[model samples]
Target: MKKKKNLKKIILILVASVSIFALIIFFCSFVMIYQDVKDNCLEAQKEYGDDCVDSLIKIVQSQSQTYRLKNSAIWTLGQLADKKALPFLYELDKSLLPQKKCDLDKYLCKYEVQKAIKWFQKGNITSWMYGNRESWH
Candidate 1:
């Protein structure tokens, strides 16, 4: 009888351990998927030029998707560094600011957008000029 009780307890503990590990893996898979999307979008931006901006803006404006994915889209938009995207980003940040309190992801997205705006307005030499030639156009 003593051995049976011990076996039952061990089995319960093992089952619980497996369940927790599975949950962790499932959560991590989603995290990986979001990162993959961010990377692919960045690649597309470079390859597609202005063609990808509309699709990216749609992703940012999408309310049905997870905020993590949306945040990734927001960051990619900033990296695109297009002046056309600036207005949409500003509208998004403005909308989020009025909330009682936004999450850290939202704050980061807003910061990234503002940083891109500054770079657009401020980066004159394109960094690759090496001080030899400067074109402001």
Candidate 2:
């Protein structure tokens, strides 16, 4: 009986450890993806000038693009905080039903669009990586 308890405890510890490790890996991957998206946005702005905002908007609007790409573009728009993109953001927000649960596969980043809209509405832009808040208002 004591041996069975020990084995159960070991199994519980192992499962908890694996869960924590998996969470850490998931968050690390997410951070890397956000960084890459930010870099891509910066590079595009440098190469394309003001048109970069339009380009990102196009990506968000494109039905052919993957939801991941669309979400990245939505995040970039929030970071850019360009007033010109506000209308497009609003349109996107209006198009989606209120999400009771996050379904990125089905809704195509509806929550991200809402977040971007909130940033625009607040007239503030915050860096996703550095947490630097900039008031564009």
CA lDDT of each candidate? 0.59, 0.71
Q: Against the true structure, whose lDDT is highest?
A: 2
RMSD to the hidden true structure, all candidates: 12.6, 7.4
Give residue 39's error in model 1 in angstroms.
3.3
Residue 90 lDDT, candidate 1, scale 0-100: 76
* Per-residue C-alpha lDDT of model 2 across residues 78-135, encoded as one tens digit per residue: 7667788889988888888777776565556678888888877776423445333121
List the candidate 2 regions with Cα displacement exceeding 4 Å.
1-37, 42-50, 125-137
Residue 40 of model 1 has an lDDT of: 45
C-alpha TM-score for every candidate: 0.45, 0.56
Q: What would the per-residue lDDT of candidate 1 be over residues 1-137, giving only the tens digit for each residue?
A: 99999999999999999999999998786556545544646544454443456666766665665666666666555554567777887777676534444564544356655655665567522322222211111
